[model samples]
Target chain A: MALIKDQQLSCSHAATPEMRFTDWVSGGSDAGDAVLANGADDLPSLLAQAGKLSMIAIEFDTFADGRGFSMARMLRRQGYAGEIRAVGDVAMDRIDFMQRVGFNAFELRDDQDALQALQKIGEVSVHFQPSADGKGPAYMV
Target chain B: MYAYNEFDQTLIDQRVEQYRDQTRRYLAGEIPEEEFRVLRLMNGLYIQRLAPMLRVAIPYGLMKSDQLRMLAQISRTYDKGYGHFTTRQNMQFNWPTLESVPDILADLAKVQMHAIQTSGACIRNTTTDPFAGVSADEIEDTRPWCELIRQWSTLHPEFAYLPRKFKIAVSGSSSDRAASQVHDIGLHLYRNEVGDMGFEVLVGGGLGRTPVIGKTLRKFLEPQELLTYLDAVLRVYNLNGRRDNKYKARIKILVNALGVDAFGAMVEAEWQLIKGQELRLPEAEIERVKGFFKAPDYLSAMHASRDLNDTFAEHPQFAAWYKQNTRDHKQAGYRIIIVALKNQLQAPGDVNHQQMDGIAALADEFSFSELRSTHDQNLVLADVAQRDLFALWLKLQDLGLARANVGTLTDMINCPGLDFCSLANAETLILSRQVNETFDDMDYLYDLGEIQLKISGCINACGHHHVGHIGILGVEKGGKQVYQFTLGGSASNDASLGKTLGRSIEQDQVVVVIGQILDVYVEQRQTDETFLQVIRRVGFAPFKERVYGTHQRSAA
Candidate 1:
């Protein structure tokens, strides 16, 4: 699997064990990163501990399941500065969109090339919606 | 029409390149067909029954003459020598090759157009009144707001892959000419009691497998915060809408599942958080978009409209065309000409390349080089001079574009159906022709008056069968195509769904049933009462009895 960070190929440093939302609510033994599923309804509880977490790897069960996109946006809007990684079914075609909606790192699916995905993420230099850092919407820019 | 700025042009250019790369990859087997399906649909390329159908956005149904010419050129070069106008006010080339779609999009980009988000699970082209700026009864022109929403929805990062396709429509006037009540999100422009112009927002209304009229989310949404409010609504749908069931994934289903009150609260909570953020429209941007839609300079070109009497005196046919195919414009001397594209020579809304060029030339000579397409599947010269009506009518007649059938029963909105669409259960274009030929008498159609006969090949409702005054749905029972008839629905200020009359009828006999219903209306109508008025007054017993008389005659 290719890991993309800062618009380039990067080694996977996120080897820490992550806490699933279900496990955390059920009182898991260990806590590291937060693994938030797209369908998880306990985002408010996760937000309460968002500051302490180093990463929130949002799960995408399928490439077409777009709940992760909105989840990333809400996480960023709530001022979570930690890395938001997209895992599972992530591909090069949607890399640019993931970045625009506040995904800082992408754990690409097995088939996609890290180098090609990087080029695609930087392709369409303008976006219509504002990024998490409020960079665009193309009109004001 | 909102002119494309340099930024807008760049985005479209880049998009063409992006879609080109995606198409190339898919063709090269680098991208699988399953994944490519989503990508191509996002670009409006649908793998149809015959060939790949390409749907190009006509932003809020407005197009410049050059753009119309470019569409004509594309249809000639890549597709068949014709293009079809859709109920959503877009253009469709029914026979485009998948390999050559990128080239077509590139050509569209040259004319400041694209097929971005016309299909797929994303926010689509936001439509409004074709007579937006020129309509006399509108509170104001809604094209600017449509443009604003278009920009906001274009390549929207989060919404690119929603659970289902999302559609939004704006109504400039309270009369709902844009069919706002049957959209995913309907924005009604109105002045509140305080005299501040805002919007009454409706969510979850759609015409599909389960047709539901939209429910109100907010009584009034402040103008500047339109984008923010929309973001909230889309976010709520994206977050909570069903992903498991494809049929129930539309926002309408989610609205019903959560109930409108709970759904509205969720959207309201999200809006409270993002209310005045970057999405807040600056007064300058709103005014800047408005400036692009301002009235053309030929405001008082009272050139020879007074000679209209002379034209009337000369040709009775021209007088009939003038009375039926044109409407009063906000500008006194100007008129909005509904170039009758719904005639016998072609299918409903189909325009050959020559007809497109003819309409473009007519617009250039008479209507300030601007044109508009309506949801009714007709073209409009929104600012034609009254004096030019006769000349325009003559030119349109020569091109076979004048039918004097606008708003009449023969001017039907028919989907491509099983002829092209893969999702269709039956064919509709030929059925539409059969009905047209059966009701070819113009005087009878005119006497019937303002009847919307919409047909759908399936329950997907692309033809908006739910809202037609006379809705016809084609379903296959026992491998035989049969049709169900509905009565008394409308897509106007008075919005309602048509009710089923009796049972399904066979294809050959569908025309007989329709004729009997129309005959019933004519037989039972009071003076000047429309089909809807007669149905509302007398209920469906008369229609049911006549439509089922043959079936029940032998059975009962």
Candidate 2:
């Protein structure tokens, strides 16, 4: 069980590297690397060293603080090909919003069940507009 | 008075089906709760702390008597026999179940009304001068243009998902009754020196957390190119508006960051590409909308009759009401009567099922069977006969809708605050009651004269406190309600933002504080100086000194 801290993580977390899920995918490390890759200085260098990183972690200090959501979108639009994992204060209420902006996995807070959060994320049946993941079929033109 | 065409009808009908489908899917457990929350809000359905509230749009505050009766029937059938008219000139029913909403939409559709774009980050209703067609001073009737914009923006594909909710208001009158300066887009219609009618377009004005006066983007946009230019402005905002922070997402912030000149240039550049394109209003279409709003055949009787003067002398109350609520009409022997919804006891804009029916009946009797909902929450019977004034007054008095406080202090503009609104931080209705009770003396209110008191429950400024002559903002401090007051705001031709008078006071102290402020005004004011003029001349210093002085003395 991943212990998702709700406080905003330091800038060093964005620079950390992780094990590659697929060689074809080239981006920063997954969000899980924040805990796995310890210390501040090594994170950015590790992110630079990865030839095909597939995921990255970002923290939301509070449920209302939406800075992390923007950070994830900026990373995706800047051509970072990776899974953006949302950690910290990521609840079921915010899952659809996070997914719309391009977050793939949400590490739930300690008190909340991850399985329930995942189920909640899968339950969205309709979307009005295209998201960071891709444009909707209706908007493909 | 602009009638919906087939295209407009079809669009609303389609939107109803869309909402119905979404509701069905939610109930069937296909869409998750959180996702459905956003979807339902977009459809103007809010699950309040108590029950489901449905907000129905009263576009540009114009409604036929039939429409008003339909609302009354809907309230009786679907809701709790009452509907609350909102600050935005819309109406909200507090107790509609989720299951009954589709039925409500169906009912509203029967009367050519729907709640589409009433909520969500879309182009909301295009509000305008309530006295649009009937105002003696109007440059042109703006209802046709408002109706055109309504059709154009309803479920518009490209601009649906903007950074924030957008509002546009237009004024045909030089007095600025529509509060055009405080809207997302404020358009003042005028005929230039060459006798060609155009709009003086103002953009980026809003009243929420960061209240701003809209800047003039176009000094003169030709009537035909209005929609295209508006589209260009919206496109610029849609693509570049900050979506990350909801607080900084309004077009005002974007316009401010870019500077007005650069923003106007960008809009002009975009307009150059699309000006002669598909969005331009066709001559036939413009005429078709205008045909519905042509002035009715009014009798050419000049001056008041002996009967009217006799009635005035016989009835002082009726005379006072006439003096305050009635306005000069363009046609001789005709007047525009405002039915004041700002009565003392009831919520500012709440018209009961019976009152709604009565108003509908009254509209049928006078005013060419048309009624308008002003932004200040009053209903206007815009073509009253001079001979029928006394009779109309008597009937209106019977229904408790004949308050003479048209633009007076007691004619307060307030939101449904904590009593019905979930977003409210404090109870605005109670504060309104307190203020009303404290200033119940009609003579005192008349003495003060034409002061606009606007209160908002929260920082969203739905009650338009930023533009009030005396603005009271309800803030929550440590789980308790506190009232903050601002002075010198005006939403008329000379629009200005209110300045904070002093520190926040407790809820109970609001009425007394307001009284003290009024006391200061009375003491310092010169003869015939209005509340706004006095505030402008003497400044907030005297009022602040009095209010704070009383506070310190009480503390000691």
Candidate 3:
């Protein structure tokens, strides 16, 4: 139940490698540190620092914003094995899609029911394409 | 026809259970009325002004004999023993109770069919040329591609809540019987310069208050990139399509807002990011879907025998039917036969349980056990041998399925209108009956030749009046039904929206107006010129002056 402000993660607040797991990762932690960003361009650097990352969150400004899904998929493809959580305007309908694209955790508002959100993940019985879960064949499979 | 695989079957089964739960919740007051309304519409159940109507998708309008029989059985048990074939190649049952819809869906699921996305804002039942596999002029059969789109678009999570409904049509034949240009997305299959089969994609074409022909967005989209390109298009529309005003909310408005070049550029930009990605259809997958649509083992029969020609010459009814209802099949000695649903007394597109069973049986016996529903609301037996047509005709006559009015005036495309549709502003079935009664001569109709009479109950154009040769639109004036006429529309290769002829007339004057137009055509037409040709040649002036001259004088 973590809250993510819209523009907290910036180049100025970059997290350093020395930062420990318990430290706050948002703006107030420190400035001029190597903080994590969630855009497609940030995937390579984030994968390079995968072990020290306590948490990685991607922003979905709208419910139907799917670029974040691809960014998460790229993270998984580049072997960033960390807690990738989706933040911002995510709803019950988008949980399964986020999961399919390799978001291990989600941060929703406290009023939202987590159980119903979890049920949405179980809606699709099969996936036509392979993704971060390392399941399903490539196109041929 | 593409038979459903296990995955398809399971998904529909799950959908039925899901809808059943939703229905139970709605009836039990667990969900509020407004919330339940969206839920029911998503499941293709509409609580109309009268009773509940359920539209079942007939995927590209192709059906196995067993599926048709199941529909007939459902009609007898759950409905009023009849179903209406819709303009989008689906069937609507007008009398199913809300409580019984889940059972009806369950029955549909059992036959590898469901009512999913048929009436929703999401991608609806994908329609293609009714004669896809059998048409002689086809570059490639478009059924597999339609089936692929059907799978990809069913209950697609992101596109489920669009501003308005979306329709996609594909045409493989040169004649464009699917009316591709008038759809939200119209795909015309053609061969590129290097002999590669692909689609010329058109977007933003629709018929309603504003009817615009879809402009070509892609010159050639290869077979595999079809879905990914469509994904790009739908995603663009979902994200940016107008949502504020229902009138300007269709994807057409968005396409018109952004000129075709800018819209195509946006779609191309989106597609460029995902073109060769997972959504790109793999070669194996294309073959996997295409394998299901391989042509039936047609009997290697050659010429129509002297006996068939002799029979035609002997019987004028048979001759007229042969000229009209029958079409050339790809294989030699085979004929594609249309079982016209346009009987004189019955409403257009109405096929009862008995007729459905008869068609199913006939399809099983003569048509490779398959049937097709045309965009024109006629049933086709796609692979009947020419020698067997006489035998098929006798069996069809016994079942009353052999009306032999495929392209005649009686073969009108009339909407349910005020009769069953809640959206209808005026009564179309009454007007249709008047037209049918007035033009009862088969010989005269055969001479008139290939006239399309499309009637819409309202401006919604559900009956496809915009593309009809003689479009009749029913409007309401002073709380009574009035009919307006449009001339020179055609849905074929030379597709054009109809031009409105003068004033709206009372319901009783519909037949007289139609008669006067036909009289004008007879007087002005060159030899063998059809109604549409005559109207196009004369530009509706003579007919307009003849029908409305006195009215103009009175008004003056």
Best by DockQ: 1
TM-score, per-candidate, Cα-based: 0.98, 0.80, 0.87
By DockQ, the candidates rank as 1, 3, 2
Across B1-556, the per-residue lDDT of candidate 2 in tens digits comes to 7766564566567667766866886798755686677667767899887899999999888889999999999999998888887767788898999998998998898889988778877789889887888778988989988987876676554555577889999999778988899888999999999999999999999889999999999899989888878888887776567877899999999999999999988888768867866567667768877898888877767544325777778898988999999998877788899999988868888888999999999999977788988888888899888888888998999899998888789888898788877899989999888877888888888998889999999999988998999999999999999988998888888999998887899998888888888899899889999999999998878887788976678889
Query: Per-residue lDDT of A49-84 in model 3, one digit per residue for the tens?
Result: 555555566765544344566556656766766666
* Residue pairs of candidate 3 with colliding backbone atoms: A14-A33, A14-A34, A14-A35, A15-A34, A15-A35
What total of clashing residue pairs does each candidate reach? 0, 6, 5
In terms of lDDT, model 2 sits at 0.78
CA deviation > 4 Å runs, candidate 1: A16-18, A28-32, A138-141, B299-304
Q: Kindly give the stretch of ten consecutive residues in candidate 2 chain B with the minimal lDDT sum.
A: B299-308
TM-score of predicted structure 3 = 0.87
Instruction: Give a tens-digit lDDT track for model 1, residues B4-121.
Output: 7787888999999999999988888988788999999998989988788999999899999999999999988998899999999999999989999999999999999999999999
Candidate scoring better on lDDT of 1 and 2: 1
Candidate 2 residue runs with Cα over 4 Å from true position: A1-141, B302-307, B553-556
**Per-residue error at B342 for model 2, in Å?**
1.6
Predicted complex 1: CAPRI docking category: medium
